[model samples]
Target: MKVLLLICVLALTACTKESEELRMRVQQSIPVPATMSQVLNRGILYPTAGIQVTGVVRVVQLSSGKQLQIDSFSITPGPDLKVYLSQNALPGNHLNLGNLISNNGHQAYNIPANTNLSAYNYVLIHCQQFNHLFSYGKLQ
Candidate 1:
């Protein structure tokens, strides 16, 4: 009986450690006024390679400025994941929006005022440390 209890405790500890490593929090929360913000373009994310992602990404025009909003998002968690506005499916010549706030839930990132929205046709979720493209959505 004592041995069984010890094994259960060990299993619980391993699960806790894994969850801690995968957990991520919002880095920035940019609020867009609901009445003033307009969604200029929107797209549904498609996973790249084997990575999994589900969400809708939106290019929002706000009275204060422009921003990228990810709504109802969930992704396979990984290290150094970042958000980018790119000219293609890849990251070359892309605008680094910022680190993704979390692997799940709604989040927003401010886009620089000088960025020409027309120049970017896709939104990318990338892993900087590993140079992996996790997912992307074509703005339409």
Candidate 2:
């Protein structure tokens, strides 16, 4: 009876450890900002398998009327993942905003606004498919 109980305890301990490791795998990809009030004052919903993500890239306008360029890039789901932006809609000089691949959802490239809008008027969100598994972002 003593030996049987010891075996059972060992089995339970091993299962617990495995469970913990699995939980850590599906973690939030994005970092939560300290001052979410300013950016996410409207509140944002982040899709979670078992992780938390907060914040998105925003275009901030400086006092000057010169569009500042911001760029960010991330690897896609597959090697061949590609992104295309609206040439006509985006600011003329501010091309090459960044690339969003199929695997990862939208990543932000913050550009300082040069117009009176004080924010980005037009944003082109690109993904391989509309209903992709990793489609996530803050609700405007």
Candidate 3:
């Protein structure tokens, strides 16, 4: 009986350690805006432009009717790009290139269903002039 109890305790301890390690990895990889103007203007000799996050996204709720959110991230190009989100991996649910704004760095939409509340995963981000993609994991 004592041997069985000891084995069970050891198994539980191992599980706890594994969980802690996973949490650390998730926290370390939260995606922020990537500065890519130099790559965008490699050939041109024009003045350098700045890219910034224009809008703030505190929390994006995903419910039945609230499936999509059109977050605007504008660039100096004078066009506002729209980012779309869906609940599933269907035609309209994934993130792509055409939705990204040229100069603005928006935190893209968060699809609640696709996100893992327990762990971090990648989400789709889109823009117009550039179809840039990024990853963001679950936050505590």
Candidate 4:
């Protein structure tokens, strides 16, 4: 009985640590009255799920760096998917925001401080498993 309790405690601690790594640390949200661009994603290498990959991609400039917010966002979930801000709307030339948080709804990802927002004009949903671009939004 004691051994079982010890195992449970260790498992819980490991899970807690993993969850902490996934959280984004953000400070200060400097909002622009309106989003600079709104976009829609269409599946690449195939037709995206008909649900309409849609959302507003806004920039919330922060003290540490820029936070790219996906507001009113929705998409079909895929394996090993991730978010990115890119110039060419392709997979490689992008600032990887991290693993995607959801198939729909609002979320925020950190944009590196070195990134030039003017050059990175689009946000992409990319599948790391298949090496495909799931969808994209062209920043207006």
The better candidate by lDDT, 2 or 4, is 4
Clashing pairs in 1: none
| Residue pairs in collision within model 4 | none
RMSD of 2: 14.1
**Prediction 3 global C-alpha lDDT:** 0.34
> Per-residue lDDT for 1-140 in model 2, tens only?
99999999998888434566565753343222222223321223233253333333343333332222212322224333222222323233223334442333444333324333324333333333442322133223
- Write model 1 residue lDDT over 51-80, tens digit each, in one string: 889999999988778989998899999899
Which 10-residue span in candidate 2 carries the lowest summed lDDT? 67-76
- TM-score of predicted structure 4: 0.62
lDDT of 4 by residue, 1-140 (tens): 99999999998888434344344432234222234443223223222545357677667655555677777666777888888888876777888878887777666676676777787777778898888777877776
**lDDT of model 1 at residue 56?**
94
Q: Estimate TM-scores for all models.
A: 0.76, 0.25, 0.25, 0.62
- Angstrom error of the Cα, residue 66, model 3: value is 6.5
RMSD of 3: 18.8
Best by TM-score: 1
Candidates 3 and 4: which is better by lDDT? Answer: 4
Off by over 4 Å in 2: 1-45, 48-52, 63-96, 100-126, 129-133, 138-140
User: What is the clash count for each candidate, in the order shown?
Assistant: 0, 1, 10, 0
